[model samples]
Structure formats: C-alpha cells, structure tokens
Target: MSIQILNLNPCYDHWVIISKPPKTPNVLRGDYVVKLVDGKGLNIARVFNTLGFKDYICINILGGDVGKIIHAKCKEDGINTLEFWIEDESRINTAVVYEYEKRMLMVNEPGPVMQRKEVENFLEFFSSVLKENGTLVVSGSAPRGFGIKDMARIARFAKEKSCRLMIDISGEWLKELLNFEPEMVKVNADELRIALDLQQMNLGELLHIKDSYNIKVLCVTYGKDGSVTLLDNRAIRVKPRVIQSDYSVGSGDSFFAGYLYYEALNKSIQERLIFATACGTANTLKYGAAIFDLQDLESQLSNVDIMEEEL
Candidate 1:
C-alpha cells in the first residue's frame, strides 16, 4: 500500500482583512474577506497533493452550509476527504491587516467542542483505516475537552498496527503525549523550550530527548536559522538556503511532507533532512501554502548544506 497519512483535525475558515487595529468599543470599518479553507492538516494535505502523493484526510466537519462549501473546495483541489459531521458550524479565523502600519493580526476561534460520543466515533474510524506497513501523520491541535489520553490512544493504536506515527503539536498536549513513544516529533524552538521546562538547553542538552524516549527522530525548526534533527545520538544541523519569502505560514508543514516523502522512499536520514530543508526554503518563494515542484526541489537539493555532529 502507498504511504497513508491520516489528519484527524481540520478547519474551514474565512480569512479577513481590516485597515487598522480596532480600539475600545471597536467598530468595523474595513473589508471583511472570507477564505474557504484553512487548517494545519489541510495545508499539509495540500502540499502532499501538489507533490503527487496519494494521501487521505480525516476531519470532524461541523456547521451547515459552510461545511458543504469547505468540502466542495477540498474536492476541487482533488484532495481525498473523509468527514465526520457535527452540530455546530466550522470556525472562521480572521486576519486583521493594518495597511498603514504594514502589520497583520490574526484572531482564531476555539472551534466547537466535541462530545464524548463524537470523539469515540472518530477513534473507531481512524483505527479501522490504519494499516500496517503504512505511515500515519497526526498533526495540529485537538478541540477543547479532548485530552492527551486521546492522543496516546491513537498513537498506541498506530504502533500496534506497525505504522510509523509523526506528531506536530505544542503545550500540555505535547508534554503528556511524549510518553506514548511516537516514531517522530517536530516542534519549533519556543515549543521545545517550554516542553523541556528550560530557558535554553545547549546542543548536548537538546539531544537528551532521544535518550528519554524511544522516538526515532526529534526535529526542531529554528525559523531563518533552519532546523536540527536528532537521530540515534547524532545531530544534523541544516542551514537555511537563501530565498525571498512572501509568507512563512505552512512552511513547516511543507518541510515535514518533504521529509516524510523521502523517508517513505527509504532514503537515509541525512538525505531526508536535506530534502526537508530544501522543501521549506522553496516554500518561501510562493504565496500562501503552495507546494514546491519536485523538479525544482531536486535542483536545489544540492545547494543545501548539512552539518553533522555526534553527541
């Protein structure tokens, strides 16, 4: 079977723009634009689709009319979607743009809370689809009231099915789920700092996560500084390739997709990290969450510098 990735959480959105920041007793004065879809997992799915990979998305879709619109957009993109319908409408995250000051502010909704039965149904659906010898990616945040135990259950199920699981999450959810022993975990520097409960840990200190968990890989993305991957007591640091960036949103997801694509092809870990960095840098050249072409990625892969060190 082809590598199968399952996205448990997804969102539909309306990205709006405002001329200025709202003050006390704020009133609307600017344009209110609505975008059809937005979510971390969906973004990853988009990138994968562009990369010509066969993948599936599993999401609990809510709301009435808007939910249909979201599903329509996904179908238009040729993305395979498996949805669980619910009572409330999907969320709309607003991005307020202050054109004069050249600043942008985003306000996100908490989304609808999932009932106990809804959660159980989602788990059962996921367990049935999961297959051994395939890879599963569980990304993004869970709805409120969903705890780490839920994550642990999914991770454990994937493990028993002999599927490689990769997670990208932050805060208490990430802290609690680390005990489940995923195949790989990715987080930004700030999240890493908070999870370890330290202001800063040197390279040596950062490598300790591998010793503590049976995790095969731990990747830390450092924005313009590029990223570092720890595997089997060796750390490889990849420097950012010079590229003009229009937006940084979804760059990490693109990187993860790139790494996993190469990994599923059985590439070495070093090669995987190099391709991952190239994918991330290539994303900087495009607007929104657009994916980089494989031909372009292959051309740029040689330019990426990977420095390896042993801890």
Candidate 2:
C-alpha cells in the first residue's frame, strides 16, 4: 500500500540525560546527549522504518537553519521526506530525561508561520503527490498561519483522491477533521474529551460519537492504563505490558505506526492491538523517542492482554 505521513510542523529535537532536575544556582551536567529530527509524523515514520517498512514518506513544512539541520539529520537517519521550505525558522525542542526518575521535562517551540501563498503552494503540492488507494496519516499540530479550515481541506481532497485517512491529532484541528470522516482515529483519552467537549468518557458516549461521525475504528489511548477501542462494532480494552521505564515521549506515535504496519499486512484487530500496544510500551524501554529494539518489541507482545469490554 502507498503510505504517507504528514506533520505540518517539523523540528530539531535535542535530548539530554541527567541524574535529576536542576536546582536553582546549580551547575548541572548531562550524562549523555542525543539529537534528531523529530515530529509526530517523523516519529511514526521512524518506528515504521524500525519495523522494516521503509517505503513511506514523511511530509512537512520546514524553514531556516534549524530546518536545514532537521533535513540533514533526517537524511542521516534514512527517512524519506517531502519538505515545503519556508523563510521562517523551524522549531527547536529540548527534553531532559532523568536517570533516577521515570519522568522527563520538555520545552517545545511553536513552529514557523507561513504566508498565504506558501499555504496554497503546499496544498497544491500535496494534491499533486496524492495517489489513489493510498493511505494518508495526518499527525501533529499545525504551524502558525494554518487553521482548522486548511486542515479540513486536506482531508476533503484526500477523500476525493480515494485515499484512506488516519489521524492522530487533537483539539480544534481534530474536531474539524471529524467532519471529513476518517477511517481510523487515534487520540489519547484527554484529547478525545477535549476535542468532543465531553465531561466524562464512557462506552455509550464513545459509541454515539463514533456512529455520528461514521468512524470505523476509534482508539482512545489511556496511557499506562492501555487503550479502549471501538472496532468492528465491538469494544476492546487493551491492557499493556508494564516495563521498567519512565520515558514515554513518542509511545503514541509508535502505537500508530504499529497499527498501520499490521493493518497493511491485513492483520486482525486482535493482532493489531496486541502489536500496537506492545510497540507503544516498547518505546518506554529507552530514553530516545520511538527508539526500540525489535527484541524488546517481541518480548512485549505476549505480555499484552486484550479483553472484550462492556459499558
């Protein structure tokens, strides 16, 4: 299957490993440092590549020196990218992972702003590259000068081109994309609540919303609690295998990648959830985002449990 991952805003991600959080007036030292081109779409692409799927391409808008660095790093990592270059500098984000703790502190920069013409040019480029019966996975937030209407237009055009749509985004962007009726929707529990403006999430409400949107597969990830999914007219609750780790930066993206990989192979939903949950949990086994050993992923598979859930 033809597959493409979309990330509207790309960035240079820097990671530092330290013993603990810094205190005021302290001279701290990092134990290790790693840097890469990262975004939700890129993370998904990385995981897919790790899983031996290398035919997909990552699509994003990048700019300035930081964008140049991002492009170079992605090339080093062997990630195929279709970039829309802009004058505004791309973003740089940092994450501090702790050695003693299972948590990380992250600071992210808002991405560059695009002019009206740039947006139009990007849409035209996206339209030119779209393939019939391809799969388009839209992930991450949009940059400045991009709005929900612009995002919806992409979805509309993808449908017009007979592409299967899957999304991993939230807030107003997600709320708007629902009208386009994507085939698969993945979001965390909090994002789902916020996007739909729900006070609480339950099976009945999930069913109502999914039916209303005609969404075929709705997956709500609950972090360490696993995920609750509505698929094939059934509710499935997945309980992930807990491993020894505190870092979970790109687990969601890994999960999305895993699901798409298995789906492309025509795996059953039961099989897909097991692999997806395993992949997500596997990402926490390391400090870097979406970096996991195939052995680790395999080890996690048998431990993941799937059960039929009821309201």
Candidate 3:
C-alpha cells in the first residue's frame, strides 16, 4: 500500500533570526534569513524522504512565482509530487526566531483561492491515484474557496476507494470530518479540546470521543509534556527525553510522519509511539522546521519511555 499526502495551502516560509526575544515597541535587527518550502503535507513528505522512505506521493496546488520555486525545491529534494496549477499566487509565510530563546513568532498567509475548474480537476486526478487499502493523509488548511463541502467530498472519495484516511487538521474542518470515521488522526491536545468544544480534556475523555467517532487510532500530543495514543482499545502513554531547544514549528507534523513511517513498517503501537515521540524531540535540535538528523533520531529512540494505562 502507498502513502498519499494532500496539502492544499502550501507556501514559501521565510525565517528571520534574532539574538533575543522581541519586546513590544522595540526595534530588532534580523541576524540572518532562511527560506524553505513549508506546508504540513510537504513537511511530512520531507520526513519520509529523510528516513529514506520513497513510497509516498506529495500532492499540492501550485501557482505564480512562489509556486514555481516550491515546485523546483521539491524536485531538488527529490520529493515526488502530483501538482495542480491554479490562477492565484501562492502564499508566503514569515517567522521570527530568537537565538537565545526557543520560541518563534509566525505570520501565515491564507494562500491562493481555487477556481471551480481547478477543484474539479484535482478531484479527478486525486481519484486516479488512490488505491485500495492505501493511506491517504490530509493535512494543513484548505484554500479560501474550498470549504467543508469540498473536504467532505475528499473524505467520501477515500471511503469509496477503501483507503485508510489519516488526518492532522483542526477547527471546523476536523469537527466535520470525524463523521466520516477516519482510520487514524493526530492532533495536539489543545486542538482536540477546541475541535470537540470540551471544557476539560483527559485520556478517558479522549477515548470516549474516539469511540463516538469510531476512529481506529487517535493520537494526542502534549508538546514537551508528552503524548497519549488510543489504539486497539488500549491507551498508551509516552514520555520523551527532555531536550532544551524549542524551534517546534513542524514538530507535530514530524511526529505524525514518524507514526505513519512506523505503521508502514508494520510496527506495534508501542513502538510507533516511541518512534513518534523521538522524531518530535529530535526536531527540537534543529533550526529548520521538520529537519532532523538520522543519527539524532536513532539516538533518541532509546530515550523514549512508553507504557500502557488502563482507561
């Protein structure tokens, strides 16, 4: 089975570096700049490629100069992509990170609006690539013109194709798609709370919601605190080795990619969680989003702790 990633709102990310954290009404000079092709799906594909797993496809919409650059960068990185061209210009996102502090300030654009024909053409192409029992990952945000209906159509297509639907999105989009009974989903704790409109969130509550939606696997990450996963009627908790760096822009995406990578290898749930947490922790050691050394990932594997808890 193949892995397919769909990212509708891909962009060129420009990162600026500073010596220290920024204060309100203070002037700051950027020490340097780093640019990359960034989007949730692209980041997942990058992780897969870095792990030397080339059995996946990255799908996105490209337009204008920014889109051209992103396309070229994907080729340079040797990432396979199924591209759809549009009329609107792609987005450019900016982030300011500090050298002394581990935090970053990000400004993201909404991305290009898709035309009617563009959306229809994409659905046609999407249907052609889907295979039985393959994994279809839908990540990132939808373009302005694509709404819940458009997203539901994608979900329905996946269901008809007999694919395992995996997602890493939040807000209204997530709330609506749960009805389709995705096979797997990964979301931060805060995103889960907001998506469910719950006043309190805990492991038990997570299982309750997971069952209500009939989801097979549900993973909730708590950043540095750790993560909890519900799989095969078991609640597994994982604690990662403490790393002193932040630079956590794409850490969640990296975690998701790690889990999917292990799943592709037919690893057990416990092993998957350990590798996922390790991938997330390893991402903190790098300045670029979702970039981690293979040796670093291997070293981190021993630093993760996993246990099953009664729910």
Find the candidate with the highest lDDT and give its number: 2
Best TM-score goes to which candidate?
2
Tens-place lDDT per residue, model 1, 1-311, is 35555544456655455656666456756665646466667777777777777755545444556667778888887877777666555666666555556555677777767778777877887778777766677777877646678878877888789877777777876776678787899888788788768655567666677668777898989877888888886889997657555456668888887887777678898888888888877776543454567776666677688899887
Expressed as tens digits, the lDDT of each residue in 115-166 for candidate 3 is 8888888778778877778889999888888878889989998999888899
Candidate 2 lDDT over 127-155, as tens digits, reads: 98878889999999988998778998899
lDDT score for candidate 3 against the true structure: 0.87
lDDT of each: 0.71, 0.89, 0.87
lDDT of 1 at 238: 90
Candidate 1's TM-score: 0.85
Specify the poorest-scoring 10-residue window by lDDT in model 1.
55-64
TM per candidate: 0.85, 0.96, 0.94
Local lDDT at 129 for model 3: 76
How accurate locally is residue 177 in candidate 2, as Cα lDDT from 0 to 100?
Answer: 91
Q: After TM-score superposition, what is the CA distance of residue 26 in candidate 1 from its true location, in Å? A: 8.9
